[model samples]
Target: MNKLSLFYLLVMVALIQISVPAITVYQNEMVLYKGSEFLFKTIPLDPSDPFRGKYVTLRFEEEEFETLDTSLWQRNESVYILIDKGVDGFARVKRLSRKPMSGNSNYFKGRIKSFYLADGKAIISLDFPFKRYYMKESKAPRAEAAFERALRDSGQQTFAVTHIKNGKSVLVDVKIGEISLKDVVSESKND
Candidate 1:
């Protein structure tokens, strides 16, 4: 092939490679900046992977929904969960949908973890996309300890602030009451 043609081919390949990550970053940034915010009640645990470094794993209290619809749901199948705030201002699942909700942006994409029938209703459990909150390595251990303490203390509340837009969600922060987890850890260290 001619040198000019080879150069053009390489350029095209490079552009394609760059565009993939660029689009993903752009979408995440848009959600973080312009999406609707919601607070999710969480149960957190700290775990570390050698390759990925340290992060806190977050499990939501509102992962299950009860419905009368008995349609078969396959594990790992993509689903949409509509969300609305509870009286306490934490997010709750409004409903489950096979497809994205039309004209509503307060929903997020999730996977079907499992489902079962109890009494007269079908209970659906969902796997949310934003499960991991990565933190600086130095702060992770302290954060984990703080999370554990907060979980044990009946007076403290731990929740995640998330932003959602167009079926995508970003985990903005993990906080104990009104203070960020990082700040909580730092304050505890100073005491």
Candidate 2:
């Protein structure tokens, strides 16, 4: 740790801090299980992506919609959103889905969703913008577990979740739940 080396290390740390993503994650970032909320970590896992469609994007993280802005909402084309627990324990978030779900709990179901971090606040973007991320700092045990799952679950690294706005990732939210890729796709179909 010579003076120059120490300065380089300090600069690297600063860059890392600046480059980290901004997101509100659940406990352990392992909200993959339906009841995972029963146990959680304030921190979440890193954000990732394989690719996205032209009109939509997909997300897989330790935490789902965590924090959100309820002002921007619609009921037609899917929009991304984060659910902030209202006083009633019923989740409330920005209406990301283009159209509201008719008798469905998941409006943006099947479609890709994103949680954006802006102005120290969070916003979500639904749909696809291609492979992009902000890689938030999630150090929870669940985050690690989710990461391991991402790697070994698919026998490959399945990245976390992140949202991009104007070509720049604004926020990233880790996903959690016991729903498997098949289950997530089928869960909405059952509805």
Candidate 3:
């Protein structure tokens, strides 16, 4: 192949590699927002990465699933978690199943990272796909500090706005007691 042709090919390949995942993520985000909304509680552990910019590490409280039959469950097995609204209207995992439940139930899929039987209960830990929310580089640290302070002082709750559709899940936003970090930073800037 000619040098120019080879160079163009390389460039096209690189662009595809980079853009495909981004496009897929964007498409999934669209589906998620239009699908079903859920809320999951979180703890603030934001840290800045030079390459990845700034992101908050989300540790979900509802990562564990309990089942009566541990024998059928295997580590790294794909599991479907049915979601339901709690009394507070936040989405929570109703149950874990080997198969996705039909009807009006909303569900997301995850892999079982670990499972064990204890006291006749099958406890499963999942590797949820949506775990981090990338944010603007400048705003992350400030938001993280403010979120941490709120968490420690007033016992504030940080919850993630999660969206799920067709067994795929995406995190939409992280709210520090109902205020999104983006809004928090913007308001702070205005004030």
Q: Top model by TM-score, which number? A: 1
The 0-to-1 C-alpha lDDT of every candidate, in the order given, reads 0.89, 0.37, 0.80
Candidate 1 weakest ten by summed lDDT: 146-155
Instruction: Write down the TM-score for model 2.
Output: 0.20
lDDT of 2 at 56: 14
Among the numbered candidates, top lDDT falls to 1
lDDT of 1 by residue, 70-121 (tens): 7778888999989988998999898888888899899999999998888878
For every model shown, what is its TM-score relative to the native structure? 0.92, 0.20, 0.78
Determine which window of 10 residues in candidate 2 has minimal summed lDDT.
Answer: 33-42
Error of 1 at 175 (Å): 0.7
CA shift at 128, candidate 3, in angstroms? 1.9
Candidate 3 clashing pairs, residues 3+ apart or interchain: none
lDDT of 3 by residue, 1-191 (tens): 99999999999999999999999988786767577888888776777778988887877777876767656677799988888889987767777778777785478888888888899888878777777889898887777777777788888778898888767788889898879978877776776
Task: Quantify how close model 2 is to the true structure by its C-alpha RMSD in Å.
Answer: 15.5
lDDT of 2 by residue, 62-108 (tens): 23443444444332344433233346333344344444444333222
Which structure is stronger by TM-score: 1 or 2?
1
Give the residue spans of candidate 2 off by over 4 A.
1-58, 61-82, 85-94, 97-131, 134-146, 149-169, 172-191
